[model samples]
Target: MNATPCIIKLSHISFAYPGSDVDVLNNLDLTLCQGEKIGLIAPNGSGKTTLFHTIMGLSQPRQGTIELLGKPMRTPKDFEAIRTQIGLLFQDADDQLFCPTVLDDVAFGPLNLGFSKEEAKNTALETIHELGLSGIRDSVTHRLSGGQKRLVALAAVLAMRPKALLLDEPTAGLDMDVKETLINILNSLDISMMIISHEFDFIHEVTHKIYSMENGKILTDEEVHVHQHEHVHRHGRHPHKH
Candidate 1:
């Protein structure tokens, strides 16, 4: 074993929505180490997004505990500190892009961290360049394409220089070329990540390990290569692989 310290840890975490009878996360336990890429896959309504929300401190677990960067989170202040080190990429890019221009949007996090205005802008520009989005540095965010918005959202998070990233549906609306670009960018980063995506191929390419979720529980934890397979089925008489 490599013995790397855990950057994020959840212990017996359980959560349910208001007025709902069923818990979305049933005593879930998970951990992420530095520099590890982990993938999560599950059917719709299986609580993948809920898990992300819980980790991001948007949804509190009714029981158990959450630790980010080895610090236990017990209150909103604790979570706020945790958020500084664990950046979350919401499924919708619009939720993260609020500033007037791309540069402002990307610099928002660093500015909040008390960086000088010039320092924040420099960091934002460097992150945008890394994502191959420098051309839109000063462009209006609302006028950008869907893929550009997603990249901008990611750039905003990257500018914060988080130790770990919680990404949900990162490649959902991206084209093949954009998806490839994102994969390359993510691979080049030296940070830990827990990515939830329905795109199995993309997950396999980006992650070294995989976990399956069902009924609000993790069903299995295995190496990505172990679960690689081609499933063939027929819609009519023709065969297709998925």
Candidate 2:
């Protein structure tokens, strides 16, 4: 609701996976407001995925509180009740896609959420068609191309009609046309989002503000900008006045 200012709030959160010596997340604090789109930038092993897991309650934090969609999420049950409302697109398409076909994978979420078979099928079909994936609805999930797999993974998430989307490397291995279409689709959505990507340009274009994660913390930098140089230059050439 617009009345609720924060869609996600993690305060003083600290977490460490089982058998880990150190905390993957160390007193991290992050918030996503309603209708806000933000980007998370960090290298691999920087605990970006851990942070998302903590928010989703896949991994519980040893300390601190998590509030989602204006309510506290302290237990697995609490998080489960709202998980469908906040879609999480996993970084690995293989991890996300397990059903036999593209249509099955896409409709799985809605089915789990109590949509009738007809309703779920229709939703999946509409989502697939909208994403230009109609041709692959019957295609084998594990046999699709890398780019197609990524897009199908996204289609699965979008079919849930989440109020908030947590996308991890959604553009990885996508083609130029697919990337552009993804960008346009994301920009058109009126939902809260926190995208984690190493592609600076894609993040910059889709999110209103960008933050860099360091040492299990989100370093706020809303003014992140990327500049382009139009002039061409040759490799291994030095620049000097004639």
Candidate 3:
């Protein structure tokens, strides 16, 4: 048996917003091991964002248990304790970069994590440089291009030195060059991650496992194959693993 640690686990999770009977996350489940990367593929409104929110404690599930950092996660406090360790890249980069300048935005999380002001600034600068973002370090956040904003958002997340990342539609609205750059950046990182994306080729480029969600359940191997994306992933004459 593999001995690697499982950092996150979602079991029989179910949820529905108030006054709505339809469950966005109906008995959904997922597991992430140390250094394991996965690509979650499902159509829009398949509880993808809801699952991310639930993991971060932004949304509460109606049923099931969540495990994080190898322990049961059941409270707002539990979520808060682990929040810094699990970085989430929202679908909209704009939602993440609220600070006036790129440097401030990158330094924000570290500051909240109680880093000394000097340490936070230094950490942010290092992260920005490592991501090849030094060019935009002092730029106005709102003035940056879409791809630039996305990269800066990522830089901010990395400054916290998280153990895992949850990236939602990370490559959306990016040009081919910027998409390639982001892909390369993600590949170089050794941290654990679960990437939510509709771009099959992009997903295949990064993740070790391809997880498909259907009717709110993460399909077993017998239930599906390679994220239900055999056709699209191979659209460019690229073969996928069986």
Instruction: Give the top-scoring candidate (TM-score).
Output: 1
Q: Tens-digit lDDT track for model 1 on 18-85?
A: 99979889989888988889999877899999998888888989999998887898998998877888
Candidate 2 lDDT by residue in tens digits, 47-68: 9988888888888898999999
For candidate 3, give the lDDT: 0.91
**C-alpha RMSD of candidate 2:** 2.7
Q: Is candidate 1 or candidate 3 better by lDDT?
A: 3
Please report, as a residue range, the 10-residue window in candidate 1 with the lowest summed lDDT. Answer: 223-232
- Between prediction 2 and prediction 3, the one with superior TM-score is 3
Give lDDT for model 2: 0.89
TM-score, one value per model: 0.92, 0.90, 0.91
Candidate 2 residue pairs that clash: none
Would you give me the overall lDDT of model 1? 0.89
Off by over 4 Å in 1: 223-242
Clashes of each: 0, 0, 0
